[model samples]
Target: MTFVTSEPYIGHMGLGGIGDSKGLLESELRKRHIKWVDNARVTSVDQDKVNVEQLDEKGRVANTHELPFAYSMLIPPFAGVDAVQGIEGLVNPGGFILIDKHQRNPKWPNILAAGVCVAIPPSRPPRCLPAHRRPD
Candidate 1:
């Protein structure tokens, strides 16, 4: 089996609390004979298939191909409350509020956020790790 990741190392989402020792986990994955494709990303998806782009050493797309599957599902990314869209620097590119450890917007100190209001990107397989995920 193969697992692909855009990161040079796995565990950025800290799955199973393994982010701190990503290299070790990667070694274990290799010992199990699983092919780990790093620096690769999914470009598109459709029922029965996914389109992937393999990046070059410099992280530019070097090649693209299909990865076929029998199942698929999808969940969209979270966004900030409609009240905050297009406002100046209040949110990230994904439209979710940016927060500090206290969950307060640094610029708008009065503002606070958590859960869906803040974007915590999913760990793997992309798009919240749906058992079967399709592209938006």
Candidate 2:
């Protein structure tokens, strides 16, 4: 079975368009007799199966089930870096810990950064920009 996370923006694109696209995709899969599931979240996965939790109208977990598949692909939610404290000159004002151009922290050279923690400087800027505006 295939699973898809429903994004809220899909509604703005028109429900009929979304439903028709889904219907076409489903029809193609149905021709191959492949089952599918939507609006279900994967809670955990093991070597042989994945545990899924079904959500209700209020976004509460209503039920759980295990599904076995020969192949699977998962796309997780995005989030910022972890909070860092007790370190001087190591974190940016925006809560993403600071790093140099090489992705190494200035204060802690051994530390490297990825994800949202890596800061990108603005292309156009005043010489004396505020601390909040600078990429650091």
Candidate 3:
């Protein structure tokens, strides 16, 4: 489980606690003779076994190993949008949804974007010399 804290003061404590909890859980599992693999990245999986690449503490690929598990949870990295060919008047040239100054679509004034992936205009003009020189 991942615990995320945005508060400046609690951020450090929350991350430290997560690390400590994971270590304690692993230690307890080891005591019960349960085998555990750390830094094993899944490359692929077949019907019986999964191909994994082991990484060193520095995150460099050191060796490859295959392991069998009754069940596994696989999480994939987030991929960006592909070519927006069929869509018309919805996406910008960069494949991102475009919005106006009030975060409303220019073509569809009723549509408003308010989420993590929503695109917003830069608060200031781009390429302005010395970041502080830009108007707020």
Candidate 4:
């Protein structure tokens, strides 16, 4: 099996990862003989192949890979509801509600955002990879 992700490295899990997650997940994938492509962007998907662009640290395509798979699963990118979108200072570009430490919107203090609608910035910036954007 092959794993493809936009994460700068393994186990980033979009939260800059937990402790040792990189090492642990890498070890496990190695043990299982599973391959992974990091900083990957899926350009297209066909019946038997997934076209992926392997991006370099500069956010440029370093290589293009045609990965063949008998079965594939894709987890679409996340986004906040339409109601919160386009509200400047209230949400990020992807529309996820921007919240303070207390889960309150900074610009709209009276409004509270919870659950998946809340935006959690990565603990650290990705080397050069762009933030995950919802598909158009």
Candidate 5:
């Protein structure tokens, strides 16, 4: 089996990784003989093949790979529904529902949410540098 991900490294899982997940997942994949490609961008997907561009440290295309598959699943970034947009305290700027300790909406006591629909703050700051340079 082959695994492709946009994450900078295996096991990042888009949340800066959980403790030891990087090592553990890498070990498991290796033991199972699963081939993986990280830092990848899916340029296109056809019926039988997926075209991917692997990026480098400077965000340049390092290599392009065409992976053929009989079946595939793509998990994109999560987002809230349009119906929940602009609901003030009930939702975050991205529209994901805001939940408290009980997974209940702060604005509406009767409402609750779960799954990807719930807003989760980043566990760590982003790794990217700022977009603009500071003045001397």
Candidate 6:
């Protein structure tokens, strides 16, 4: 089984920062022998193979390769669900749910959200999204 994701880090939950949890996750993946590819973009998928496009340091496509799979599960990028997506005030421009200090929708206080779709700024760089908690 192969899990492909664009981001490098694993265990993106709030309790452990991206740096801390990845060691454990990587160790376990090594123990179980799972192949983890970071910073990869899947260009296409077919019955027998998935085509991957890897970029060079200059932000150009450096290599394209095919990965074979007997059974593969693809978890694409998380977007706000269709239910609340694109509603004028409910979501941000990127379609992440807009929440207040309580993680409840600011405009509609009764609505609460959790998981990958909540709008939190990246902590490290220009673009990254890790789970953010209210600091309990």
Steric clash pairs (candidate 1): 73-132, 73-133, 73-134
lDDT of 2 by residue, 63-85 (tens): 77788878888865532355664
- lDDT against the true structure, per candidate, is 0.66, 0.60, 0.53, 0.89, 0.84, 0.70
Off by over 4 Å in 3: 1-19, 75-136
Candidates ranked by TM-score: 4, 5, 6, 1, 2, 3
Each candidate's TM vs. the true structure? 0.55, 0.43, 0.39, 0.86, 0.66, 0.66
Residue pairs with backbone overlap in model 6: none
Candidate 5: clashing residue pairs, number: 0
Task: Report the number of the highest-lDDT candidate.
Answer: 4
What residue runs in model 2 are displaced by over 4 Å at the alpha carbon?
A: 4-19, 77-136
Cα lDDT tens digits, model 1, 29-123, are 88999776666778888877878888775567888768777764444433467877866667876578888878888889898889877755444
- Two-way TM-score contest, 2 vs 3, winner: 2
RMSD of 5: 4.8
Q: How well does candidate 1 match the true structure in TM-score terms?
A: 0.55
**Which one wins on TM-score?**
4
RMSD for all candidates, in order, please: 9.9, 12.2, 10.9, 5.4, 4.8, 5.8
lDDT of 5 by residue, 17-127 (tens): 778888999999999999999988899999999999998866899999999999998888566878989999999988999998899998997999998888875565434
Q: List model 4 lDDT by residue over 27-80, tens digit each.
A: 999999999999889999999999999988888899999999899999987678
- At residue 55, candidate 1 shows an lDDT of 79
Off by over 4 Å in 6: 12-19, 56-59, 104-117, 126-136
lDDT of 1: 0.66
True-structure lDDT of candidate 6:
0.70
Candidate 4 backbone collisions, by pair: none
